[model samples]
Target: MRTIVITGGTDGMGAALARHYLGAGDRVVVVGRSRAKFDALLTSATAARAEFIAADLSSVADGRRVVEHLRAGHERIDALVLAASFVRQRRHVTAEGHEASWVLFFVSKFVFVTGLAAQFGAAERPVVVNTAVPGARADAIDFDDLEMSEKFTFARSNAQQRRANELLGILAAEANPDLAYVTWGPARIVRSSFAGDVGTAMKVGAAVLGKLLGQRPDAAVRPVIGIIDAPSPGRAAFRGAKRRPLTIGAHDDKDAARLAAAVEDGR
Candidate 1:
C-alpha cells in the first residue's frame, strides 16, 4: 500500500479525502491541530493502517519537526496532500512570526515539499496536491509585506495566499520533474470552516452561497480521490466531480523562480 500524508485531516475536505483513501486500503497519515478531532476521525475511519499527528502546521519550525518525526517513522511517502488552508477574519501572526493563514497554506506546504524532495529524492515520483480557488489565479503576490500589515484587506490576503500555493506547486514541479504537482479547486465545500473567521457579513454571505451551490463532503472528495489514484495530463486545476481540466492560470518560469528564491530567502 502506498503511504499518503494529508494535512488538515481533522475536518472538511481533508477528512473526506482521508476516509476515501482509507476505504481504498492505503496507509494514511492525518495531520492537523486537534487531538480530539484526530481521535474522532480515527475512530470513525477505523482504518487498520491509519495514523494521526497533532501539529500546528502554521509554523515553519513545526513543519520541520513534522518531517523529522515522519523520517523517524516511515521510509517513503507516496503522496502529500495539503488540505488545511482557511480564511481568517483578520490578519493573525503565528509564533514563528508568519502570517498565520499564509504560513499554513503556503509556507508550511513549501517546507514540507522541500523536505520531502531532500529526503525521498526524485526516484519516488511522489504526488503533491494543493487546494486552491479561482481567487489565486487572478491576483498578485505581495512579497514585500507578506503579512499585509499596511494593506490588511481580507480579500487581498486570501487571493495572494492562494496564488502562493500555485507558485509553490509550479516551483516544486520544476525542481523535481519526476514528481506530479497539482493545484485544484475544491469548488467551495459546504462543510468547510472557511468563512468561520470572517465577519457576520461574509459569514452570512458564504452561508447563503454555500447552501445554494457548495458541494457536500462526499461530493467534494471525487477530484481529490482522482488526484490520488488517477493520472493527470499536466499542471492544471481540476474543476468538479468529473475531474475535468480547467485552464485557471499558468506559472511563469520567472515568477516561479522568484517564488523559489523568496521562500529560500524567508528561511
Candidate 2:
C-alpha cells in the first residue's frame, strides 16, 4: 500500500482526505496540533491504517521536527498533502516570531516539502498537493515584509499566501521534475471551523454562502484525489477540479529565486 502524509488531518478537508485514503487501503499518517482530536479521529475501524503525529506547524522548528520524524520512520512517501491552514481575524505572532497565518500556510509547507525532497525523490510516484485558494493572479510577494509587519489584513494576507503557494509549486516543479506538485482551490466553501475566528458578519455571510454553494465533503475531496492520482505532472492551480494557468505578478525569475532563497534561509 502507498503511504500518504496529511497535515491538519484531524478536521475539515484534511480529515476527509485522511478518511478517504484510509478507506482505499493506503497507510495514512496524520499530523495535527491536538492529541485529543487525533484520539477522537482514531476511534473508527479504519483507524487501523492510520497513525498520528502532533505538532504546531506555526513554528518552523515544529515543522522541521515533523519532517525529521517522517524521514527517520519512512523509507519513501508516496504523497505529501499540505492541507493545514486556518484564517484568523487578526494577525498573531507565534513563539517562532513569525506571523501565525504565514507560518502555517506558507513557511511550514515550504520547509516540509523541501526538507523531505529526498524521500519524495526515492518514491515510485511522488506527489505534493497543496490545498490553497489561487487568489488574484496579480498578487505579488512582498519580499521586505513577508510577515505583513507593514500592514496586515486577513484578506490581503490570505491572498498573498495563496499566491505564494502557486508560485512555490511552479518553482518546485522546475527544481524536481520527478515530483508532481499540485495546488488546488476549493470549488465551494464547506462547513468547517476555518472561519471560526472571523467577525460575526463574515461568519454569518460565510454560513449563507456555504449553504447556497458549498459542496459536500465527499464531493469536494474527489478533485483532490484526482490530482493525486493524475497520470502527469501538475504544475499549476486546480480550480473547480480543472487545471488552470497561474499568473505571477510583476515578479519574474529573480523574484522566484529570491523567494526560494528566503525559504532556504528561514529553514
Candidate 3:
C-alpha cells in the first residue's frame, strides 16, 4: 500500500482527500493544527487506515516537527500533498515572525517538502502536489520586506504567496529530478472553515458564489487524485482538471533561491 502525507487534512478538500485515499486502501497520515477536527475526521470504519499528527503549521518549528515525525517513521513517501492554505482579511504575523498567510501557504510547504526530500527520493514513484493558485506571477521577492510589513493587503499577500508556491514547484522539480512536482488550482472558492476568518462581505460573497459556481470539495479533489495516481514527467501546473501554461516571472530563479534560503534559515 502506498503511503501519503497530507497537510491540512482535517477539513475541506484535504479531509475529502483523506477519506478518498482511505477508501482506496492507502495509508494516510494527516497533519493538522486541531485535535478536535482530527478526531471528527476519524471514524470507526476508516480509523485503521488513517493517522493524525497535530501541528500548527504557521511556524517553521512546527513544520520541522512534522517532517521529523515522518522521517522517523517512514522510509519512503509515495506522495506529499500540500493542501493547507487560507487567506486572512487582515495581516497577522505568526510566532515565527512571518506573515501568517504566507507562512501557511508557501513557507511551511517548502519546509515540509524539502525536509522530506530524501524520503521522496527513496520512493519508486514520488510525487508532490501543491494545491495553490497557479500562475499568480510576481516580479520578485522583496528582500527587505519578505513579510509585507510595509503595506500588507490581502490581495497582495495572496498573489505573492501563490506565486511563491508555483516557483517552489519549479525549483523542487529542478532539485529532485526523480520526483514529479505538480501545482494545482481549484479555481472557484468553496465552502470552508477558512471563510469564517475573512471579512463578512467576502465570507457572504464566497458562500453565495460557492453555491453558484464552486465545485464541491469531493469534485475539486479529483484532479489531485489523478496527479498522484498517474505519474508525469518533470513539473506541471494545473487549474481544475486542465493543464494550463504558466507564466514564469523574470526573477523567478533569484526569488526561488531567496525563498529557499529563508526556509533553510528557518525564519
Candidate 4:
C-alpha cells in the first residue's frame, strides 16, 4: 500500500483523506498540533495503519521538525497533502516574528517540499497536493514587506498566502520536473476551522454557506484521491476535477527564485 502524509489531518478535508487511505490499508501519518483531536480521529477510524505527529505547522521551525521526523520514520512518501491553514481576524504574528498566516499557508509548504525532497523522490509516484486556490495570483508581494507589519488587512494577507502557493508549486515542479505538484481547490467553502479565526460573523456565515453550497469532507477528498492515483506530472491546478490554467502572475523567473530563496532562508 502507499504511504500517505497529511498536514492538518486532525480535521476537515485532511482528516477525511486520512480516513479514506486508512480504510484502504495505506499507512497514514497525520501532522497537527492537537493530540486530543488525533486520538479522537484514530478512535473513530480504528486503523492500525494510522499515526500522528503533533506540531504547530504555523511555525516554520516546527514545520521543518515534522519534515525531519517524517524523513527518518518513513522510507518513502507516496502522497503528501498540504492542507494546513489558519487565519486571524486581524494581523497576528507568530513567535518567529513572521505573520502567522504567511508561515502556515506558504512557508510550511516550502519547508516540507525542500526538507523532504529525498523521501518524496524515494517513492514510485510522489505527489504533493496543496489544498489552496488555483489560478489565483497575488496582485503584488512586496519583497521588503512580506511580514505585512507596516500595513495589514485580512483580505490582503489572505491574497498573499494564496499567491505564494502558486509560486511555490511552480518552483517545486521546476526543481523536480518529474514530481507531480498540484494545487487543488473547491468551488465552495467547506465548513472548517478555517472559519474559526475569521471572527464569529464569518464563522456563522460559513456554517450557513457550508450547508448550502459546500461539499462535505468526504466529498471534497474524492477528486484528490483520484489525483493521487494518476496525477498529471509536473505542475497543475484544479478546481474540482477540472484543470485550471497555471499562471505565474506578472512575476518572472527571478521573482520565483527570490521567493523560493526567501522561504528557504527563513524570511
Which candidate leads the pack in lDDT? 3
By TM-score, is 2 or 4 better? 4
By lDDT, the better pick of 2 and 3 is 3
List, residue by residue over 42-155, the lDDT tens digit for candidate 4: 645455788899998888889988888998898888899998766577877878888888888888888898777778778888899998787655555678888788788877
* Model 1, span 126-210: residue lDDT tens: 7877776633553467767776877887778778877777667666766666677777776665656662466888888777877
lDDT of 2 by residue, 91-206 (tens): 99877778888889998888887788888878888899888776555645678888898788887888878777777776766667888887787776876666336788888887
Clash count, one per candidate: 0, 0, 0, 0
Question: Which regions in candidate 1 have their CA more than 4 angstroms from the true location?
Answer: 43-47, 118-125, 134-139, 193-195, 241-251
Which runs in model 4 stand beyond 4 Å of their true positions?
43-46, 193-195
Cα lDDT computed for each candidate against the true fold: 0.73, 0.80, 0.82, 0.81
In candidate 4, position 48 carries an lDDT of: 73
Residue pairs whose backbone atoms clash in candidate 2: none
Which digits, one per residue and each the tens of the lDDT, describe model 3 over residues 1-267?
899999989889998888889888899999987778877877787788788998878777788888999999999899999987666889897766777877888888988878888898888889998887777756635566778898888777778777788888767777679889888888666566663368889877877887887777888888899999997857788988899887676777887888888767755
- Residue pairs clashing in model 3 are none
lDDT of 4 at 18: 83
* TM-score: the better of candidates 1 and 4: 4
